[model samples]
Target: MYQRRTAVRRRKSRLPSYAFVLAVVSFMLAFAFPPEQPDEPSARTLPVRSLSAAACSVPPPVSQGAEPSIPSSDGEDGWMLTLVNPWNPLPEDYACTLTRLSSGHSVDERCYPDLQAMMDACRAAGLKPVICSSYRSREKQEELFQNKVNRLIAQGYSQERAKAEAAKSVALPGTSEHQLGLAVDIVDLSNQNLDSTQETTAVQQWLMAHSWEYGFILRYPNDKSDLTGIIYEPWHYRYVGKDAAAEIYRQGLCLEEYLEQTA
Candidate 1:
């Protein structure tokens, strides 16, 4: 009987030891590690994977002139804006008002006059002036031009035709509006969804009501594609200075229309 009692006690002690071993094994397996641990804790897990070394990052969006998921925040994406005068593309030597580039996205430099005034006015109106795209270098244009050409070729266009089509969509080195340093691509300040539809923002109404006051004119319009040799672009606004903005708004003229009358 003593021997039998001794055996029961031994079995009970073994149960606790077995349970402790199982708990230790569970902890190691749960952590994907061995039983032995390093004195130091493992490095913290990082979930973000960045493609570049830039300190700042911009979200990925399709190239410009391509429709945003937002369905454009304005008419024809805001091409209905008034063109005050013929924006004789300003001289190249003009200094920019302020410049900010977007990293990991296509946005480059923010040019002066219009962007500066627009930003100030937006702030004053309690709006945020979000830059969509700014200045693109000649090299950048070439890259875009080449990409368009490639896409056209893939779509069965011959080299010459692809070149021609690309020309309409992609500006040559000196001909780009960006070269003038007065254009900016901005998003509506009130609502900030990357993919929000135009109906979701009031920028269109605000711009229509006040864009001319800031010396800005939507550079291209649905009514003037033939003259510009490009499709209507609503987000692009040119800074023609206040006088031109006034005349354009007053006469209900686009840049093309104003140019025709003056010419």
Candidate 2:
């Protein structure tokens, strides 16, 4: 009985010594080699992915005052070349006086006269051009974008996938040119649908051929979606001033390409 007790005590005493030795080794190892810490990113080098969803909606803040006007090689109003897209976002302070059309849709007051002239010319040509969509506020743009995302989600796309697909059709809030009051979606009065079929209408044919004359261009042309980051929207016309519009049409260049070449 005594032998058994002595053996158990010895085992218990050895355990404490073993634990103390293990702790000392651990301390020594820790002191000899400190853990390596990850390097922190500089403020300027911070990734966009780290931003919140709301921050991601609009692009990184670009100083409105600091924005350089695109060079006007042909004396086009450089301001007319303000580029807004998935990568380039509309400045937060962007403000324009809206002029409501007879159809109740509003557009930038700066482009109203040219837009009216274009519509009159189209009518004179016996083509019925109808302004179906014009300037959309950020709220309206968000609603349209969310509706598209929801539709894609209903079709079994994951949330992230749905948002990406939706962006191709409906521009996210500040990324849409419509928010600048410089873009209008015109359709045929007889067939008022926003789709590829609209491109076949007489109104689209007339506008496609002559919109540049009125300081507007077919904003999204066929096969240029890779550059525009949006689908071919034949009816969407953007007012880039007559000279720039004419140059864009002549070069068969989308706004992005035109800006890059001009820049």
Candidate 3:
């Protein structure tokens, strides 16, 4: 009986150690293989949704110091947003009512008032802005292109090379935005040169910063020439109506990109 009781005591003494080992083993197993978590949406998915929303949202109209309200898409004025480039040429019969400016340049009648207002504002700020070029008939554009090509050829470039070189600065007839009457080339009165260097002047800087307020945008910004299919032209501005201009300015997009994104 005493031996049996001693055996029972020994078994009781080992019980706590066995329980402890079992608990340790369970913890090690849990550490090795954890429970599966429920799948959740990833963070990367948010931007796509946000981008979709942005793409669909209508651009807000400009406020305070903004130009006139943009017309409805059904109106003739809607042509303000038309895209003209080497790839997208103007229609053969396209035309608009022309209004002559005091500068001897002409623009679409619809845009003339805004153009005058913008120039007036510049003059108020002591900047002498000059309109260097504006509306061009198809024949005029052809002449300009041929003149540039001839000049390049006279400089000893091959015919093919001359055409290519001239096209870099002057668009081929139907592709020239000047034919649209909504585009204008402006220069400081003291320096009428149209070059990339014009971007450095205070007048040009002012136009770049404030043109959107008057329903205008820089047509070929220095960084957007590749997309515009033209060289960087700091002096060129296009009237795209207030809302579109503001949106284009806000996004820093060329007209082609703006059209593509909205389309």
Best by lDDT: 2
Q: What is the C-alpha lDDT of each candidate?
A: 0.51, 0.76, 0.74
Return the TM-score for candidate 2, rounded to 2 decimals: 0.72
Over 4 Å off, model 1 = 1-114, 123-128, 189-201
Tell me how far candidate 1 lies from the true structure as C-alpha RMSD in angstroms. Answer: 27.6
* Candidate 3 worst ten-residue window by lDDT: 1-10
lDDT of 2 by residue, 184-209 (tens): 99999888988999999999999999
Can you write out model 1's per-residue Cα lDDT over 4-30, one digit (the tens) per residue?
A: 000001111133455878878676775
Model 3 / residue 7 / CA error / Å: 87
Error at 222, model 1, angstroms = 1.3
Q: What is the lDDT of residue 26 in candidate 3?
A: 68
Question: For candidate 3, lDDT tens digit of each residue in 1-263?
Answer: 00100000011113355587877876797699773333432222100101111221234344435433433332334467766777667766667778998768898887888888999999899999888899999999999999999999999999999988888899989888898888999988777888867998878989999999999999998887666778999999999888888988997888765654454
Give the Å error, residue 173, model 2: 1.0
Runs of candidate 2 exceeding 4 Å displacement: 1-76
Return the TM-score for each candidate structure: 0.52, 0.72, 0.71
